[model samples]
Target: MVRPDKVEAVAEIAENFRGASASVVTEYRGLTMAQLTTLRRSLGDGATYRVAKNTLVKRAAEDAGVEGLDSMLVGPTAITFITGEPVDAAKALREFARTNQGLVIKGGFMEGRALSVDEVNRLADLESREVLLSKMAGAMKGTMAKAAGLFAAPASQVARLAQALADKRAEEGGAAPAAEAAPESDTDSAS
Candidate 1:
């Protein structure tokens, strides 16, 4: 005697679970619909927040083969499915919770593992993936530039030394006085 609507809901939730890069469960007990809308808007394009019955969510998780989140599906749960970046979603949730105080971050699932509330907070503290990647790229570029300089330094120094020696020889050639050869000429005559 299962309702078609219920089955559909489960399927939708399961699909969301499958498609999300990460999922965070939060308790939004005291927030009104308006506040919820505001929270949703704040999550931006990378995440979607949905309110669902705990039973339906549980069933969906089971269907989706997502484990370690059953305990998090308690008490007026709203799940945030993140598709872009997990850190961005976590940061949005954390920021909203800090201001609203009604959005309680329960836990999350990411990368085939469960995240505790502390872990979620830690995730929020991290920089976005793009930022981290750019920093790493900058560091690698700097290292490469340094290596190139290290590889080229000795050759450049040797070239400069050779040029300096050549300039000295040229200057001596230009400054050659016939008087300096007088001693040699005198020795040759004595011989």
Candidate 2:
């Protein structure tokens, strides 16, 4: 005999779990309502923090095809459903936990993989997606510049060689006239 509201809540949680990119389970035993609100605000648009009954969460996880959350669901648990960037959400959770000792990060799941607290901390240490992309783009640009320089080297060397040959020809051409004039004067003297 499940209540209608509880059934609806389970449905919503299941939907969230299905849609989330990552989800962190935290034990918020000693956190006050105001502190919870502050933490939620800190998570920002990247994550949705919610408190659900362990039984409902279990049912929702099962419905959503997510496994290994049954043991973590015990105690006063709050789940942070991360839909945007997992790194950002992990950073927020880690920072909040540092200041507020009441929040204990149990574990999480990301991309169908379970994560321990140490794993979550590692995730937080990772740079954001945009930062990583920008670094990659910079590296690609540098590689392309080097490739262009390599490609142009032969053409530049050819041009320099042509200029050197032209200069040599000019020098020879000027000397020929002087040599002929000197010979003509010699011939006139000899005659």
**For every model shown, what is its TM-score relative to the native structure?**
0.89, 0.91
**Top candidate (lDDT):** 2
- Residue pairs clashing, model 2: none
Question: Candidate 2 on 87-180: residue-level lDDT in tens?
Answer: 9999999999999999999999988878888999999999999999999999999999999999999999999999999999999999999999
True-structure RMSD for candidate 1: 2.3
- lDDT (CA) for every model shown? 0.95, 0.95
Displacement of the residue 83 alpha carbon in candidate 2, Å? 1.1
Q: After superposition, how far is residue 81 of candidate 2 from its true place, in Å?
A: 0.5
The CA lDDT at 96 in model 1 is 96
lDDT of 1 by residue, 27-89 (tens): 999999999999999999999999999999999999999999988987899999999899998
* Candidate 1 clashes between residue pairs 3 or more apart in a chain or in different chains: none
Q: Give the TM-score of candidate 1.
A: 0.89
